[model samples]
Target: MTDTLALAGRLLLAALMFAGTAQKLASPTEAQALLALASLPPWLIWPAALFTAIAGIGLALGLATRPLAILAAAYCVVTSTFHVLMDDPWQMTIAFKNWVIAGGYLLLAAHGPGRFALRRD
Candidate 1:
């Protein structure tokens, strides 16, 4: 069912974002290196980490799924742009991931969270 698929996708993305945030938190130096490679402002590093973690938690719980997905999609877009600018061939991977995530977000945004969502009031 579409609901099942969406839930699975949302959970997967949440896990991915959580892992990324953990990496950033556990190894800030590595995070800094990647951010530097992306040319993102150093000050943004911590805020970005926090946003990703919070958004991931929200999406996983199906709470404000649409808005959180949108925020996550925006974050993915920003990071994808940086990867593209870096000329990393991995950018292609990031692009596809971002696109899929954005699609999921758009679907949730349009369809509400379907059944099985916390907001299914």
Candidate 2:
């Protein structure tokens, strides 16, 4: 039961993150605007966006979940901190969402994906 729930949670978060990354890719201008609002440099936006997309796919597929989760957690923390510190109203919700995702990633990192993951042997 716990494994099922965790798997579901991971899938949902992965989908959400992937969607976000897609949006960034589809509309770089919009993404850059948001990043600017958060005071992030323009050069860093593309790399961050790419990593988020790849990490989301990795998490969804249960491949390298530990390292990917750690990377995602770190990215979430940095992005959330940027949002909070910049006082971006549009990003406040994202900041909270990132924190939640960070917690989920950390949990997965510590516990592994159990039997529900694709990588389970």
Candidate 3:
């Protein structure tokens, strides 16, 4: 039951990562705009997409679970900066959401990947 729940949580987070990556690829305009707003290079979308894909797959496969979760949490905090700098209420909400997601990742990191993981540690 514990392993199952851990796998479920990992899968959910993986889905989020894949969905975000897909959105970036399918329609990059908004992401690019956000990059511009943050004074970051628009071309960063490609690397970001790649990172998400790799991290998502890693999470799904339960590979290097703790490290990946920690990295994902850091990624969330870093990305949230774009939304944090915005003056709009909606953007602020997004930033808060990112932080919450980061917290989840942190918990996952602390919990390990359970017995269902491909590489447990």
Candidate 4:
């Protein structure tokens, strides 16, 4: 049951990451605009999207679970800063959500991916 729960958690987190990646890909304009507003290079969206895709895949497969979870957590925290910069109140909510998600990733890092992982550690 622990393993099942861990698997479910990992999959749900992966889905969330994948959704963000898809959103970035489907409409680069919004992301690029955000980057511009943040005084970051707009081309950064490419690498950011790629990293998100890799993170999602890793989470889904439970590969390098601990290290990946840590990295994902850091990613979440960093991205939250961007969301915080948005003018919309809803975006601030999203920023807080990102921080909450980061906490989940940190917990996953501590607990590992359980027995269902491709490479449990």
Candidate 5:
């Protein structure tokens, strides 16, 4: 049961990351605009999107789960901070959601990916 729950959680989180990656890819202009607003270089969009997509895949497959989860959690923090800094009510929701995802990622990191995962550590 615990393994099942962990698997379920991992799948859901992967789905979330994949969705975000798709959104970014589907609208690179918009994503680039957001990056510009964040004072980041536009060139970062490609690498960021690629990392996100690959990380989502990695998470789903339970490959390098610990470090990947940590990186995902750190990404959540980075994005959450960006939204929080925006100071808009609408952006606040995204920030909140990122923090929640970060919590989940952190928990998964500490707990391992369970027996059903591809990688044990």
Candidate 6:
């Protein structure tokens, strides 16, 4: 039961990241603009989106669980911090969600991805 719950969480987080990936790809120009607002390079939009997509897949499949989870969590923290710095009221919710998602990843990291993980170590 615990393993099943953990798997469910992982898949849910993956789905969320996939949605973000799609959004990024759908509007790279807008994403680039936002990245610039955060003092980041516009060229990173594609690579950043790809990172999320790949990490999302790995998280769902339980492959490279620990490191991927950490990456996802770090991504969340960085993005959320940017959003907070930007102080966009409209995007504050997104920042909040990112932190919440990061918490889930942190928990997954601590829990060892449960029994359903493809890579136990």
Residues 16-119, model 1: lDDT tens digits: 78987998888778667667877666667799789889988887888888888777777777676655534566767777777777776666666766576777
Q: Which stretches of candidate 5 lie over 4 Å from their true place?
A: 85-87
Judging by lDDT, tell me the better candidate of 4 and 6.
4
Alpha-carbon lDDT, every model: 0.75, 0.78, 0.92, 0.91, 0.86, 0.85
Candidate 3's C-alpha runs over 4 A off are none
Model 4: CA > 4 A from native: none
TM-score of each: 0.80, 0.81, 0.95, 0.96, 0.93, 0.90
RMSD to the true structure for each prediction, in A, is 2.3, 2.3, 1.1, 1.1, 1.3, 1.6
Candidate 3 TM-score versus the reference: 0.95
The C-alpha stretches of model 2 lying farther than 4 A from their native spots are: 37-39, 85-90
Candidate that beats the other on TM-score, 4 or 6, i.e. the better one: 4
Per-residue lDDT, model 1, residue 29, is 82
The RMSD (Cα, Å) of candidate 1 is 2.3
| lDDT of candidate 4 over 1-121, digit per residue (tens) | 9999999999999988899899999999998987887899999999989988999999999998888889999999998888885569998998999999999999999999989988888
Q: What is the clash count for each candidate, in the order shown?
A: 0, 0, 0, 0, 0, 0
Residues 3-99, model 3: lDDT tens digits: 9999999999988899989999999999999999878899999999998999899999999889989999999999999898556999999999999
TM-score of 2: 0.81
Residue 49 accuracy (lDDT) in model 3: 96
* Top lDDT hit: 3
- Candidate 2, residue 60: lDDT: 86
lDDT of 1 at 61: 83
Candidate 6, number of clashes? 0
Error of 5 at 92 (Å): 1.0
Clashes of 2: 0
